[model samples]
Target chain A: MEIAQIATIASKEFWDRIRNRWVLAVALVFTAFALVIAYFGAAQQGAVGFRSIDLTIASLVSLVIYLIPLIALVLGFDAIVGERERGSLDLLLSMPITRLELLLGKYFGLAAALAFSTIAGFGLVAIVLSAKLDLNALYHYFGFMLSSVLLGCAFLSLAVMLSVFAADRTRASGLAIATWFFFVLVFDLLLLGALVVTGGQWGGEIFPYLLLANPADVFRILNIFSLDDVRTLYGLATVFPRALADPWLLGLVMLAWIVVPLGIASWRFRK
Target chain B: MASSLPPNDAGAPLIVAQGVRKHYGNIRAVDGVDLDIRSGELFGLIGHNGAGKSTLFKMMLGLTPTTAGDIRIDGALVTGRDFRAVRRTVGYLPENVVLYDNLTGLETLWFFARLKGVSPAEAGPTLERVGLAHAAKRRVREYSKGMRQRLGFAQALLGKPRILFLDEPTTGLDPEAIRSFYATLRQLRSEGVTTVITSHILAEIQERVDRIAIMAAGKVQARGTVQDLREQVDLPLWFSVRVSKEDFEAVRAALSHLQVEAIEAHDDHVKVRCRREAKMAVIEALARLDGRVRDLTVREPSLEDVFFGFSD
Candidate 1:
């Protein structure tokens, strides 16, 4: 509840990452990936040069969905457990700060670092594409960057939650990887199997709602749905209902993803 | 601000614990422990490993919740919520704290100062106090173990706490550093800072603390001043008597009634051990041996012996 304590812890956590070059490394990864996807996005189609912002965003959407979550998970999976292993938790806890403040401060600080790197990384692509692409494409790319930060925060929350529940670093990281696999790879496959076995009868009505359950899918639908051709190309326009594709609603869902896991993390951390 | 006294000896003790217990599942880490630490007293807690020393220290700082009982610091109860305020007025130096090696010594102290809600500007002077002022700009990773310990001590000295808790503080310190460490602790005590330090190195803290508590198997086996403990344990005293070569037999024979064991019968000295109560009698016996004894010395049992005696 004490903002000063939270800010102190948060600032320390943020600077620690900055000193370790994690922020710069992640930013470089984003910039390199975005630049390549922007300049040579259609290399498979034998096309080169800055492409349409929509095309760049569509490609970047898939990239962010996989990359941001992984980055966030790795960045945060050891937030609490790492402190404990390093034998600093006792000193930290002995301070005049509450566990909630520590947990929130760590989350927000790392979230800021992740958000900063994401913006710096993708903002470069935005600037380069700004001259070539139109205002609408520019908006979509900015939206892509925002959603990417949200997804990172969500995954970071999950990572911190794992750090709290896990007994050690090894188990925390294992649970983090398992979480990534479930959301990115296994969740959709299982949903598709449920659809096939049900002959599109039992769970078909609830399929779109279920897609909203995963922050990655919510991020995907939010970005691609802004464009007609890309939405059709991605084929999510048919699966995710138009009403549920409201950017505002999906943003709320992503916000929930960020808060709910972090809330649980704080709860478990205090326990 | 808490430096002033209450005008009389009616002020509350610095720390009060009543039947404080910590149970991890079926394991009783601290069981029914009652303690009182007075203001400006430098107390020592010595126990074997896993003797619940660290656990009790943690409970005092409100780092861990007690399974039962209560602990009060400066008359304020320490709990999950209330301990936050009390923590600001206290300092702690844990055993083997691995700080952020990436930050300089000054920066590390500032970070901890900020946590304790004190001014980071105090970091420089605090480092100087711990003899790390010249190395302020050096990163902690480049410092030696002794330097790191000084940094930890510097952090604990922040805010000029009324009470300081140190757990096994001299683990890696050299003799000179240990001496200086106690000197600093004595200086703090002069300022009315009650320090509670735990160490397995009994010799290091024997003469430094005001009182000592010997813990064994989650309980305080004995608690008193070193002299008081020596009086409590019925340990035998050592006596070395110097006698001439011609009178060694007479001196030994005279002291044989006291059941003194002849450790060595040198021409100049005869060593024996006896209980403290028999000291005067044995000296009298030696005196009656025709002035054969040239010199006599009596050595009382040390704190180490008393510690082991009570621990066993």
Candidate 2:
């Protein structure tokens, strides 16, 4: 693999987002939402002000779980298929670069864009609340920002995978939306319904392990398990074993979510 | 001018395809075919929409895998490990070439130059070479169709590649741009760049390309110089003779002694159609009429006629 070739394509994709203000727009959205949730999250409970960092991160996690995946999917759903449909794929393939290199370049470029926006958007919030929070609170907020970036990368990987396998942009987009619905909305609910219908008799032992199957859940667990207050508030501390909640282990699972889909996309694109 | 001599006079074959084939399940996009393109030669591939010219072009560039056989460029298999090195020395301009609409003309060239491992600084001069330097900073979305085509050509000229593959290169160019495009091609030829071009406009490339390949029904029906193809097909030639209306019969009688195909008289001239072998004899017969033949113009078969002769 030529690093130069990959870097060239990656830089082009990254700068395209930068020049078009896609990165700026996404960062602004994240900042606006994070600030609102940080200051007004407890309003329904008859309290509104600068809340505890733990409670703020918990609310932000729920928002990111829905927002990042959708942004990532939209950002990357057209990576390969768009080139193919626009008739640029032939010219790009005709270059000296390999298909694997091109695929990796595209993935890394868009991943960088999504990661940048996630960091900038939420990092601004961390600064705003830094004076009120202690060192421990700052560390948890930093962890939340990191996990949010990973979730975006994972979903971007899936979107690129769909771009390669899909016949056109329309189909790739449809597959992307379907992927978001399944992972962000339906995966955990189906696991819960399976357990309840079986009266806890079926798949109970593997329930916590199955949560790792969804990157969104992994992101949620990664952020929630690190904070003591948020961990109990979600009631996941009882069913999700303490041993399996290691932040390092959950982080590795998130990395796998990012890598595996890209691996499949590279394979399909080579064919 | 290269057609005047034998094709081998140019150099050894730089690109060779041996029984190359590509099948899309039931459809044979490129049937078994053999071809050789010599170094520094301008070659043309012409055919109808579904004649598989594009498929064969793609296979030659390794953009599409061949179902069977092998294609080698400068002795390196297009599908093999050394293809990256081979590709580095090759340039391609795809048909209806599409570039990033969001990029400036200069940025577009730099993007391709980086991919080809060339210096981004070359983008300016390359854009100037294609007459696109004036619009270097303008986004491609604002360029006209002809300007986009020029930018695409500029991208292909990066890295000073030794070989070029152009597909329907003049699709949207004006007469002046078309003239300059071929002029640049001629300059590249002098630098020993072997170019293989495909065109739907037969007349546009007939006089420009050194040799031509006519494809039909997924096969190369004929391949050679224009003159060579005309001779192979053995189409008839036309001779228009200008004479007084009263001497029309006399002009016909002069050529009647020879094996002339047909002779018809118009208001100002008479048209004579005859076989290729009978050309010199017919000319001699017409020359014998001397004073009666006020003027004589010999018209050989056109490239279109030769194309239809073989493709049909």
Candidate 3:
């Protein structure tokens, strides 16, 4: 539990990613997508120019749900297994640091990298949208950005867990992709199919809880439920109650999403 | 476990293993083994591949859990959280450690120094110690295999650890570099740093280590000084005599009077094998030829012979 050792590992991971152009590449992608969506999100509705921050956030929420999780998974899928394969794991584990410290250091380092790109990418668009929107709109957009970082951390945690549990790099990468596919695409469909088959009979009471199971869905509900127009568009008022949609509770869930998988990884790595 | 440790004039045993074993499913990597490495001793572990040298080394470092017995370092059992504190005072250079190639050699050393809680200022001197100071600023990717091994050695020398474990440290080193490597190891030993090194190349470490352990099939076949093992095996000595073309037959006839195990005759020289006790007698018989014998050489059994004798 030495902070110095953890900081050393974290700083190294941070520099390693920067040197590999991962941070720059991801930031550029986010900026490009956010700019295009912020400027042209209303074109589908026969409108153009910088739309309201609400519509911009709605567009970016879906974008972040798909993009951030994928980026995060790709970023961390090889964190542990790759090091083991590279023959560096023995050197690192032989150091004076604990396994927990190594796991946390790597997670924080990668989380910082993902958060940096998320902020840098979305912050640029926020500045552009600042002149067109008021303070309230800016606050909502920042919340969206914060949630995007959380979603990234959550997925990064899962990726690190997979890296620890998988036997090799190829298996780790495969598990990372499968995790992304399951959470981002298959989760919602499975939830909806379950609802339709049961006709809200068997698992109706646990439906909202099940939606919270997927961090991506949690990110979706957090951003989409905040705005009135977006809320009506997503239409989760019936199954998802108002109490469960509280921003604080949803944020806690996202934080748990980040911590639990990382905690499990630390446990498994120590074993 | 306490009683199993041997008395050490160098202070106390720095590393102790009591019947340590490791099992990977049905396969046994390290069978029951007992060992003691004293402080300031340069110990060598020689074994063929799959002989469990690496497994035993890992068990000592607590990198892998021992299946049945226990290992102690500095009198404290290396298990659970206690070993974490012990690790700070230990250094290890595993075989084929691929460092972060993107980092400059100095950056790599600094990172490990920080992890070990040493000052980054120590990186320069450590690199210089391993003769990598000139290339400290170069990226590791640009370095050769030998250079990377030196970097790994430099990292292990950080903080001047009390005990060092080097698994196949000289695998990729050139002859000159290997000489310098042993020189550094001797310097460390002079400073009272106990070193445990494993190498399959018995010749490389025969004279370098204070004591040697030969392992086979996941067990230590023999462990002691090279002289002690040689004496135990008591293999016959070899003698080669060079004589004039006319005197070669006379020398062979003189040697046939003694109990020669085997003999070979060339155009101008004769090679003979005799038991250990017969060495002096054989030399005396050759001395009777005196001026007729142009040259004489005695070949005692080497550590390699002892290693093979026990390993078989």
Per-residue error (Å), model 2, residue B273: 2.5
lDDT of 1 by residue, B37-92 (tens): 88788999989888899999999998888889999987778774567668877889
Alpha carbon lDDT of each predicted model: 0.87, 0.91, 0.89
Considering summed lDDT, which 10 consecutive residues are worst modelled in model 2 chain B?
B1-10
How well does candidate 3 score on lDDT at residue A84?
Answer: 98
Ordering by lDDT: 2, 3, 1
Question: DockQ of all candidates, in order?
Answer: 0.85, 0.85, 0.81
- Expressed as tens digits, the lDDT of each residue in B54-171 for candidate 3 is 9998888888999999999887777766776678778999988789999999999999988887889999999999999999999999999999999999999888788899999997
Global fold similarity of model 1 (TM-score): 0.95
Clashing pairs in 2: none
Better of 1 and 2 by TM-score: 1
What value does the lDDT take at residue B234 in candidate 3?
88
DockQ, computed on Cα atoms, for candidate 1: 0.85
Pick out the ten consecutive residues of candidate 1 chain A with the lowest summed lDDT: A128-137
List the candidate 3 regions with Cα displacement exceeding 4 Å: B1-11, B243-252, B266-268
Query: For model 2, what is the alpha-carbon lDDT of residue B218?
Result: 88
